[model samples]
Target chain A: MTDDEVIHMEHVWTRFGENLVHRDISLSLGRGQILGVVGASGCGKTVLMREMIGLQTPTQGQVWLLGESLAEADARRKQQLRNRCGVLFQGGALFSALSVFDNIAFPLRELKTLDEELIARLVCMKLAMVGLGETDALLMPAELSGGMVKRAALARALIMEPEVLFLDEPTSGLDPVLGEEFVGLLGQLHRELGFTVVMVTHDLDTLSDLCTCVAVLAGQQLVSYGTLDDAIACAHPFARDFFHGKRAQRILGRSD
Target chain B: MLASQSSAETSALPPLSPPEFAVEDGTAVVHGHWNLRGLIAASPDLRERLCRAARRPDLEWDLRGVNVLDSAGAFVLWQAWGERLPERISLRHEQQSAFRRWQTGGIPAVRDGRRPPVPIRRRIIAAIAGLGSHLLAVLALLGQLILDLAHLARHPADIPWREISATIHETGGRALGITALVGFLIGVVVSYLSSLQLKTFGAQVYIVNILGMSIIRELGPLLAAILVAGRSGSSMTARIGVMRVTQELDALAAMGISQSLRLILPKVVALVVALPLLVVWTDVVALAGGAVSAHLELEIGYHQFFQKLPAAVPVANFAIGLGKAAVFGLFVALIACHYGLRIEPNTESLGNETTNSVVVSITLVILIDAVFAILFRGVGIR
Candidate 1:
């Protein structure tokens, strides 16, 4: 894989006992592209994302993230690679024991080099970037509302200035207004930082607004992987139904 | 500058250069990768350099050669420049946005230094207040349980049989192996020790009396109570604590289900029914162990030992042991549920409450055993 390809999967096959999730899937995500993975329920969108991040290994084939083979990297090398990327889990997944300020500072503190003052300043900047104020920093994750949780988690993700970010259902639980605001924030950050994003999302609004490219997963294979119009024009029945549905039509139609 | 090149060129980029500054011709020339990684690698010396440069008011700043300045790098530069942009700094067009962010989003206030240690007088007063609140809460929980029992009495159909059965299996049925092992070992140890003492006094036969009274009346009930308190009490509290964390308890309340009846009552009933039986089971195994030990040590046959046990230790002692076991079970379950219900919706609180439940229940068990000993002092002994 070339250096510009931030993530590359080669002939990956995932199986659980007798069940097959992914079969001979190959894809490459270039740097600075927001690629959204979409599929019907139980079609392994999450499992595919997991494989990309090296959380789960495929039964066959190799996955390379940031030009290093995930299967070949040792523990320390894996940790270094992990430090270069950030993941926002479906649930906010903030450490419950830590307050918002500490959660954002966690990655910085792990470096063991940044002074507390610099770490604090960076955390505040990130919180403000994500539209949270300084006063909200002391609140624990459990006390945060759903929208604030997402914003706080986003702040934590971006604290390290990661080269790439992986998001699982970034706007799943938010109301329409908040979801839109989150998408706007994400887009603004993307423009400013130019980091690659690989997100698994079911929301049509999120896919259309944030994703530069979409990969449609179906029938244990990548049926279509391209721009929105390309995905819609594919001959696969799942892709047709996905992009031509009434809701998809309304959203994509308005965007066009 | 090599760090900013696009990755399309297959040549690997040079390793990040640690941020540095050199005063040349009365201007501070800053260059290299000024991002988090480079800044961290050279943090101490770099910060010292920045601070020394900041002190030189006459020096014009040159930052046009700096590569990849992130928010962290910007914040460091901002702090060194007295929380504002330097008037004489040269910057690249793209580098201006990082500073623009700082201008729009004003500097955050630094946290004050460490808090003062609390005074002893205030600490004592706070402790007393905390104790008072805990006592009140425990009493309120007991009152609610009483009311729940009264309600269940009025409408027997509302009883949660499945929950009770589940608790029974979890707390009692699954605990058989460990309790049996411990009981038998303790029995052998106690019997052997007593036989040693009796042999010294030419009173080997009295081993039966000592083992019967102590195992049946005291050790059996206390052992079972302590074991169950550590095992089941913590688990009960953790289960309810997690339910509270996930808002499952609130969901049940919204569905019009009484938490006391459905959750607390089943545990209380299960422990009350289960503990006495466990005590009895422990007592029998202990006696068998004692019989074997006596046979080996004192040459007392198993038949003689069993035959003499009932005659030596009266029936009232057995009754008192069972009664204590029942009371210990009730208190253990109640205390566990009380702490469980008190947990806040956070993992820290869940962990703290579960630990507190186990500790407090075990302490309560010992305290209640003392009270039982005092109240039933004259009845259970000869």
Candidate 2:
């Protein structure tokens, strides 16, 4: 099971002082699969994503990325594993000081293995793939619109060609047009690049279209985990309300 | 905790195989893990080797024996061959799919890393414009503060003394201990040093004049101002900067609340009130410290030092110190609030502005003190 898993979390609990954000949570993501994480506000979906990426660690239990336990991997192993994955933090955490091109080239430069010439070309290609023009590369993060910032962040996340990509709330603040366009881009990149993606999001269209599986977090535990249809059919109260909610029903084109 | 974070304790690159190449009969044979993991270890050697290989008439990616190939590995291999199927090559199902993705998808081709450079003159002009805009906005905020103060004076009941007093308690009252500690320490060092020089001249009695004039008039207010600038001033800028980044300031503005009255005015008023009092407190503590040090070093009793201090340093010097403290306090708070309000909606701006607030205010305090020293030259020379 561990050999085939890209991400695996077991009995994970995250507590800030006295408040427990997650409890008794366990889940696994298969290789080459898209897993959409969803929950109500404050339910710790993003916390789970952070744990998998080693940005956050659980107070109890384990988080394994690409089959190596993050808590156990040595520095060298962790660095190797990190190079195999990418993360798009909430609000597109691009460095405000660097230009868009520099932000995208950041990981390549850090790897210390690639020449500037190759890094530049890779940055340009990523910009093009994310629907941004070459000219946009010179603009700073502050200069870009929200959608453009997200796209530029996405391009930066992809520059390394990681085997796994994790996104936190990829479409929350985007307008509907850009939201749809982003989902389309995600699908296209996932297919073309053949990387596993774990997105923490509440967007219904993304859940239905881009995700191969949906994991619902609620009441300090994973309430539901499966395909979108499985979530809609789940008996848990929050899962039922979420899938059969008026907005979700309208988006899914279902009467009940 | 990844490499991109840079703050991670692990700074060394992981050892992985850089792609290896060999020349064979005017052909290049490439082999190794160019997979998701191996590509992270791409070094100058691999690039140079690849570049040299690209010149070969026939290049072959003998992938039949190699393992660990992914998009990154395949992409680099494709790039080495100039994004085309090589003149002669080997075949495998996984390797074929990797190359096919490159053919069909977006991959950056190799090229010189160069961007059209901006002329130095243009950069300098842009920088000057930015600085000019910042200064102008700060002047505008100063005008708004004056108007708010006038309005509050006319309608005294509308003043938010509750918030203003609370801010004073938090920023000023809590700062007393550290201020006293540092001020006393500074006084001790100054007196001890003066005693050394006075002893050499056998004029130990004049230590009273030196300590009294410097601590009461110059060092006390300057020390207090610098301490507050570091402690309270940075905190004020950081608090307001965070409010801007989180859009709490926007929420206040949206509800038609006057930010000047509800936010900026209280901070400015609190500092203006707290600072002069703090300077007085600092002066008293420093004098006591100097008297104690003088007694220990010069065997001149506290009674003698205290008696001589009044005649040596005039009350006019103390008044000048008070005046400088008030002005310094006002400028520090105003500069802090100006930078805080100007913080862009980003985390980077919050840190940058907080640093600027403390640094710029401290520099201005010294400059202003120099101007005061020149203007009051005759008054404090008793």
Candidate 3:
């Protein structure tokens, strides 16, 4: 793997009992690129993403992240690798027992170096960046609205200033306006920090608006992986149907 | 400049330099990577140096040599400079935005001003008020339960038999093993201790009277109720609390379903039906345990102990135990459902309410047992 390659998978196979999810899937994501993985429901998009992040082991083959082989890394080395990446799960999995402030402060507190005062300042800055205020900090995760929960989860994800971020359906539950705002915030942060992003999304707007590269998964493999236009022009039946479908046509056409 | 320094290494990037600042000729020159990792690696010393440099009234800041600056680094500098930019400073173009973002959006205050401690008198008053509110809420729940029962009585077809059966299996069938173990052990202990005393007074034959009266009329129902309250009551509260957290209760309401009828009534009905049977099972097991211990310690035959139990304790006592068991079951179910409905949509509240449900149910069960003892004082005892 190249030094700039943030994620690399070769001949990765995922099988659940008798069902095969991925067959000989090989893909690589470079530094500072937003790569969107799109596929139909139950097509192993989440499983594939989970495999890339070392959360799940593929039945066969290898996956490397940030020049470290996931299969070869020990627990401590794996922990160090995990520190450099962030993930925003589909359900905004904030610690329900903690307030928003503590939730965002959790990762930094684990470092055991920074003082509470500095941590608080940093947490406040992140909350501001994500369009939350001081009052929102004291509220529990269960008290937050759907949009607020997403924002809070995003703040926690970016707390460590990770080199890479993995988002699972970042804008799925949000309305269009909130979704657009979230995509805008994501794009701005990406430009400023220049971190790599690997996102699994079904929203065409998110895929078209923020993704620098698109990978289409169908028929148990990566059918297309390239620029948006390259993915749209792919001759694969699933890829064509996905990119040239009515919803995709309207959204992609507007973007053009 | 540090980017070039990092790129100069071909195979692996050199370790990042921690943020450092030096006051050179009336200018505070700051350099190195000002990111989270770099700052953390040099936290205590770097923070002191930055604060000390920030204290100089005449020092101009120069940050042109810094290669990286994230929000954390920006925050450290922002805080050290007294939450504002230094009057005279030079920053690299890329690094300027990090500081600028903070300027445009005013820094949010982290700590709310210190809250004064409540006065002692007010604290007591607040405690009393909280108790009053809880009492009222419990009463309100009981009212709703009565209305639900009336509705079910009128519309027998709408009664939730399936849910009631499921709850019975959960609370009654699953609890038999634990209740039997505890009841048998208590029975054995009481019988053995009483036999030792009776042997001293030459009253060993009266062990049957002691064991039968206590186990049948009091200990049997009390032990079963307490165990069920601790085991099933907490679970019921947690189940409803989680439903509240996930907004499932609201969903049910939106679909025009009565929560009390569906959720609360089933548990109440099931416990009422189940606890009496459990008490009977516990009474029989405990009496058998007592008989075994009596035979061993006092040399009384099993046939003699069994034959004397009926004549020793009247049938009125058995009826009273069953009645007390039914009452305890009713209250335990009511208290569990009460706390379950009162839970707020948060995990901390869920935990607190579940604990309260078990504790309150057990306490109420004991209190009701005392009331029954006074009310039925002359009926069962010889």
Native interface contacts retained, candidate 2: 0.24
Could you report the DockQ of all the candidates, in the order they appear? 0.35, 0.40, 0.42
Cα deviation at A42, candidate 2, in Å, is: 1.1
lDDT of 1 by residue, A1-256 (tens): 5568899888999999999999999999999999999999999999999998899999998888887777777788778788888899989899988988888899999998877888888888888889888678888888899999999999999999999999999999999999999999999999888899999998889988889899999999999888977787888888888888888889888332
Model 2 Cα displacement at B351 (Å)?
4.0
Winner on lDDT between 1 and 3 is 3
lDDT of 1 by residue, B115-175 (tens): 3479999999999997898889888878988999899899999989999999999999998
In candidate 3, the residue pairs with backbone N, CA or C atoms under 3 Å apart (3 or more residues apart, or in different chains) clash, namely none
Off by over 4 Å in 3: A254-256, B1-14, B21-31, B53-65, B78-91, B112-130
C-alpha RMSD over true interface residues, each candidate: 5.5, 8.0, 6.1
Better of 2 and 3 by lDDT: 3
Residue A171 C-alpha lDDT in model 3: 95
Q: How does candidate 1 score on lDDT?
A: 0.88
Best by DockQ: 3
Q: TM-score of chain A for each candidate?
A: 0.97, 0.97, 0.97
The lowest-lDDT stretch of 10 consecutive residues in candidate 1 chain A is A247-256
- Fill in the DockQ of model 2: 0.40
Residue-pair clashes per candidate, as listed?
0, 2, 0
What are the per-residue Cα lDDT tens digits for candidate 2 across B303-356? 999999899998999999999998988888888888898888766788889999
Instruction: Give stretches of model 2 more than 4 Å off.
Output: A13-18, B1-31, B40-71, B87-135, B196-204, B346-348
